[model samples]
Target: MNGNVEVVVVGGGYGGVTAANRLARRDGVSVTLVNPRPEFVSRIRLHQLVTGSDDAVEGFGEVLGGDVRLVVDTATRIDAAGRRVSLAGGGTLSYDYLVYAVGSGAADPGVPGVPGAAEFAHWVSDFEGAGRLRSALDTASASASVTVVGSGPTGLETAAELAEAGREVTLVCGRVLGPSLHARVRRPVARRLAELGVTVLEGAGARVTEVTRDAVQLDDGRSLPSAVTVWTAGFRVPDLAARSGLRTDADGRLLTDTTPTSVDDERIVAAGDAAVMPDHPFRMSCQAAVQLGPAAADTIRRRIAGKTPAPVRMFFAGQSLSLGRNEGVTQFSYPNDKVNALSISGRTGAGVKEIACRFTLNKLVSGARKASSRGSHGDSGNRLETPQPEHPTTPHGTRRSA
Candidate 1:
């Protein structure tokens, strides 16, 4: 602990980026963020990417710290024993503290035909998948039926986006539409989707039994004609942590206690959708990722200063589900994330959703730039602005704002 603390953050998503910037605020802590992509992806807008409403990318400067090292590379393996991370491209980097935040991806439901049908289905999980989905929509015939499997927020938003654009869309809900919402609030969501011209298929026959290129077969022997099938069911995390010999949960997320430190190794910590906080077990969402990121950084910072870290507590306002540009739904929830049943819909809901998305970006950028004000102007709080000219570079390029 005498020398500089070498902290390597894996994954450049919201959690990792937030941690890197916050950690860079303190001196004697070397922060390096390794990610597969050079640009920061706005995951909240990835669905917009599919609908051609957003590009969902920015130069690292907009979201990463001025003093943090940015390594554009994929982590192949983690050697926890030696504190070394092997890169897919080659070579390895050592760290005194490792922050695991690789995030999650589209899950395979182990259906009979899911794996083979994946090639024909569209996904909104990542940047590459979103781009592919956009291209698919372009080539799909104007009157072709677009079936969106699942009724989660992403599925709902995508179906609404396509329907609003005049595309024939169907939302195949395995159970019920907006299952997370209370029965009272879910009624309005159904009415809104119906108003938007989305076919909400629920009940016993709605569960997907098979996926084909041109249609999705349900358990009730009904086959919905789908020119472009989109699967947005469940998600699974990367297996890097499990393969690295770290103690992880069933889904490969690192198992951590209140401190967010790996049960097997005190030097390793985790955050984001990929993390399963044993104490709180928060759901995988950007809301949790933002907080978890800084918490992980604060833990490392505190541990280096010979102090114990505090457990993470997250706050929730509501769930924002965009029906389209003009219609949406916002379900109020307590700080514990329990639905309070208070709701908003139509344009007002859409406005709230838009503000949340924009505010999320502002918070990320502001958090990253907070390190620049360290000690110089007596500024210590997390406040963000566009990057300044004096911001230092790491290796080559990977910085930008706006």
Candidate 2:
């Protein structure tokens, strides 16, 4: 753990960016972030991107630490034995430690076994997918019918955004709308969607059995005309970890211990949606990514100093849903992430959702600027504004949280 430490952070998403910034605050640490795109994508705004609300992209220079190197390339493989990362653009970078944060994206459309789902349905999960969806919408008739499959946060937001844009929309909820929210919150959300003129098909027999170029078939023998079908059913992580022969859960998430270190290699750690904390697994949302980012960095910083890495501590507050630009819903949950009776809706909820999105970007910028604070004040205790080990808790599972 000697002269200087070379840390290569794969994936420039929320977790990788925050981890790079925090790690760069310490002296004698060279942080290089490898990502396929040069700009930082604000994934939460992807739904907005589809409806021409927000482009959902920012320059890495605005959010990344000035000292951190940004490599615009995809990671092909991780050579753990050689401590090297092979890039898709050619050449390999050597690293003393690796941070795996290659976040998740839309799951395979073929997974549901619905015909034409993969070829016909559009997605809004990733940057390129959102752009493709936008292009498809732009070319399609404005009066054309739009159908959104799945009722997660993404589906709800996308359907609402499209409906507000004056698109004839139908929401085919696979099972229930806002399945993770408390019954109290779900009621308000359904009301808002109804007000937006969203045709919500819930309860049994609402699941889509087939997706065609012009319509969708339901399990209950119903055919809905869909000029443009959007599929946001599920998400899957990149196969880079599995491809590298690293230990991963069945979902292809990198398996880590309490300290967030890879069970196979001490020099490797994980964060974001790609990481699975078996003991305290949480959802795949920005909430978890921002917190886990600094914790992963803390682990690396401790190891570099020849100290034991501390265990990661995390919790959840609630779920935020933006039903178009004027209305929304916020469902409060216990620290354990169980939906409680507490809830908020209408304009107040919209304000909360907007503030949360703004705060996410601000948090990254603040973390990047912390390097100067380190020089002025020296490494202070818990410099990163990440969640601390105050009250460690776990969540039920993944659910929609915008």
Candidate 3:
């Protein structure tokens, strides 16, 4: 490439910020990050935002690289054939390469027979929804009942946080609590929730069939009074890739080969919850997003140098769940994400969880500093070093070429 290589990173979450910083390290590479909000959202602490424990947002100046152009607007469409991205704020950006990292949000409440859920239940998956729920809680009476639907980590964290804050909380697990956790680890989590005075509802009978303004109807002919309903179930990604005629999985995540290059176009790569690497198929967690972001950026850098890009490598350490401000659990796992027997709980676990959150922010800040320092010397060979797990293991599968 004779001139500057333009790269547009869509979304400013963990993935986008990291990718922008990494790409900006190389000379003659221009990085532009397009995000709806000017501030960076720490999504891992969203549950804390609901309870007024943390703000869950940071100034973009703290995380994003100085050399990266920040576009405070939404990306409406991607014209892949023309190498252009249409913005909702009225304009188009021509890119030599694009990185798709639009994160995820709560799944819509439109179950088969579950009516009124979309209108009645509140969620805390995104920043806007979290703010709305916090306001609703402020005005509600102290005696109002709060019901959290879903047994996933989000549900567990939300229920525990609210219960610890003196709210009459009920966790309605449609089936079992911590479905993905090993049975041994789930035992301690259940004990902590019980200590916090949360009403845990399990079994088929606990499944919520309908959500109303005042109560929720269960599958087993039971009606529970719920003044504030918080839905924290599954997550759904943006439809940007699918709408743009790019190859996507059924869930609308951009379908990429092992190199994380879109099968539809080699110049378009993806990361975070918005991308699906067919061979790896990792879960949508910050653990994966932080690593995949740099991997995607590395692919673009390699292509710019006329070299073959290496396949993406991802490793998971474990699941970190904060029960509340004081208590939490760290369920360690293998690189493949299968829960192992080792675990930590109580206050020690809380410390570990807090460190993980801070580590993400620190990682971005440090990466930006390194990139900025290297850019000053006019050297493109200096690579941004991303931290790896202590015990790394190879993901089982052959690479899928784009």
The weakest ten consecutive residues by lDDT in model 2 span 392-401
Error (Å) of candidate 2 at residue 81 is: 0.6
Model 2 C-alpha lDDT per residue in residues 1-402, reported as the tens digit of each score: 778899989998999999999998999997888888868999999999999889999777667776676766788899999998887755577889999999999988888688899989999999999999999999999999999999999999999999999999999997788788887788999999999999999999999888999999999999999989999988999999999999999989999998899999989988799989888888899989998999999999999999999999888898898999999888898887777989889999999999989999999988877753545443222121111123211112222111
The per-prediction CA RMSD against the true structure, in angstroms, equals 4.8, 8.7, 9.2
lDDT (Cα) of model 3: 0.86
lDDT-better candidate, 1 vs 3: 3
Error of 2 at 70 (Å): 0.1
Query: What TM-score should be assigned to candidate 3?
Result: 0.92
| lDDT values, one for every candidate | 0.81, 0.86, 0.86
What tens-digit string does per-residue lDDT give for candidate 3 at 1-402? 679899989999998888889998899998878888868899999999999999999877668766676766688899999998877756677799999999999888774447989989999999999999999999999889999999798999999999999999999998899887888899989999999999999977988889999899998999999999999888989889988999888888999999889999999998799989877899898998999899999999999999999998788999999999998999999988988988999999999999999998899889877666745544222222111223111112222111
Clashing pairs in 2: none
- The TM-score between candidate 1 and the true structure equals 0.92
What is the TM-score of each predicted model, taking all chains together? 0.92, 0.92, 0.92
* Alpha carbon lDDT at 112, candidate 3: 43
lDDT accuracy of residue 73 in candidate 1 = 76
**Which regions of candidate 2 deviate over 4 angstroms?**
372-402
